[model samples]
Target: MIRHIIAAIATLLALWAMVFMYQLDQKAERFRQIQEIIEKSKQEVPVQKTTQPIQQIEESSVEEQMKKEEDEVAKKLKALRERAGSAMAFKVSPLYKQKCSSCHGVNGEGAIGPSLIGKSEADLYKALTDFKSGVRKNYVMYGLLAKMSDADLKALSEEIATFEEKLKAAAE
Candidate 1:
């Protein structure tokens, strides 16, 4: 009975090996066919006839093409400048910069934290106090404001309240 079991296990392993080899062969055959197709495509591409006389490119068309390229570059540069300008558009107090800028963006435009711009100073102060006093549930905000004084929080709120006006001025 043991001999029969051992023989059966050996037969199953041999069958599995055969199936794996067959699958591998199929994949290898497909790879070879794909390589052949790629080689044929490369060889079949029509080579431009060098025997034909080269026509002189028009100077006006060349100049026009160069102008179009320059315009595209200038447009891309302008877009990049706009993005950079918005990222650090207005200045904030050093206290806010140190405590809030990492999450709340340099201009209070919001990064990880919600936008503080356009908020009333009272609303801002309330939210900051809530975070500090454990009224709000955010661990990150609570941790950040924990060590800070009420005066600092009030100062930050006042500075944040003016972000919208500063952004408007920057836009102008």
Candidate 2:
């Protein structure tokens, strides 16, 4: 009976050892496969190459194209500034200075012409339009407004009508 029991225990131990050995071998094989994959990936990764002659030529052409674009943009901006700079400045008083200030006073305080300081925007716009259309006639004003567009007239009126506010701001 003792001999049978011992033999049974030995057999069980042998089976467990065999299973452990097989599992270890499987794990070692898995580790070997992972190492191979790592080595392959390292070889597959691309390295940055030195620029070739053709690439260098292409880069120079691209740079020239960019420079041409920049120059064109600059020219366009200069043309724009030349075209509408006065209007864009939002100070139509310069126009007044050129055409109306000698008569109207520098601040619309009334020189030879009537004071424009406290005029409403609507009134000023109507007056300017009336002047332009010859409904209100002054030879000098008529000539000054003859070629002015309605938009310019409107802008001028808006600026002139705000003179009181400008005066108050200056005082403060």
Candidate 3:
């Protein structure tokens, strides 16, 4: 019968269409898997942008950052500086500990480098300025003082000059 033959033909077409669509879907899936594999091979695992830590440097102003850098306190210190004024201002500073303690010892007594104790503020300042300006070219000192500001140089000089007093206190 023609009716039965037509029904058989329609069923065959439906089944073939479904098989074709399934093969296409599977091929698409394989391509996606291969892309992921390639990314993995390149060590570029995809991460959400929001998952990274936010850096404040891009947002903050240079002046704001400088003011925020260290705690500024009004304290008196004594030093025989070239330009000695009535008040020698001092603050609780971590710059020496952060920068010089590794080579000069924590107390400036002595270590990998010579003792910095009892050095005059003028001497310290000149030596540091020379090192920073490359007038005195020890690769290590040059590197250490290279990035220092004038304010930083003066502050460090003051702090290191007071090490003699700190030594006296420790002895007591």
Candidate 4:
């Protein structure tokens, strides 16, 4: 009976050893495959010597394209500024100068406020009335127009409506 038990234990130990060796061999094979992939990726593929000149030409062309784009953008900005009237050369009423120019700009080209240059007299008058009556919600405009009479509002609107003409005349 004792001899039988010892043989059984030895057989079980041998089986466990065999399983551990097989697992270790599988892990080593996986490690080898990963190392081969890394080596392959790190190897540099050589470029043809003739392609170097072509690459330089392409790079210079790209730089030239960028410079042309920048020049076009600058020209467009200059034209836009000229069209918008860069200088406030026209005279304005004292009432408008005092009350409107602070936020609307000297030539009504807009500063903190929206541009008032292209609006019609009627539109300007309506907007002024709306602001004064609290139909529109700008606190600054409401406060400014609140104490003004209808005549003053109308005069301001008419003057503002002519801002585009004034700018054009000044530019000429």
The candidate that wins on TM-score is 1
Backbone clash total, candidate 2 = 0
lDDT of 2 by residue, 47-161 (tens): 3434798877776777678779768866755565444222222233556665555555555766557889899989998988898898996555666677999988888888898
Per-residue lDDT of model 1, residues 1-172, tens digit only: 9755765664455445445434533454555465467456653233333443442244445556877976886675566555444654655677776677666666787765678889999999999999899898666676668899999989888888999999999889
What is the lDDT for 33 in model 4? 67
Lowest-scoring 10 consecutive residues by lDDT in candidate 4?
A: 42-51
**How well does each candidate superpose onto the true structure, as a TM-score?**
0.59, 0.45, 0.46, 0.50
For candidate 3, write residues 80-172 as lDDT tens digits. 221122111222256875567555655575555689989999999999999899798665676667788999999999989998886666456
Per-model C-alpha lDDT, please? 0.68, 0.64, 0.60, 0.70
Q: List the residue pairs that clash in candidate 1.
A: none
Residue pairs of candidate 2 with colliding backbone atoms: none
Off by over 4 Å in 1: 1-66, 82-85
Per-residue lDDT value at 65 in model 2: 85
Show the lowest summed lDDT stretch of 10 residues, model 2: 83-92
Candidates 1 and 3 compared by TM-score, better number: 1
TM-score of 2: 0.45
Q: 138, model 2: CA deviation in Å?
A: 1.4
Model 1, poorest ten-residue lDDT window? 43-52
**lDDT tens digits by residue: candidate 4, 1-172:** 8655765664454445445434533454555465467556654334333458888787677767877976886676556445434433577787876667656766687765788989999999999999999898766676678899999999999999999998888779
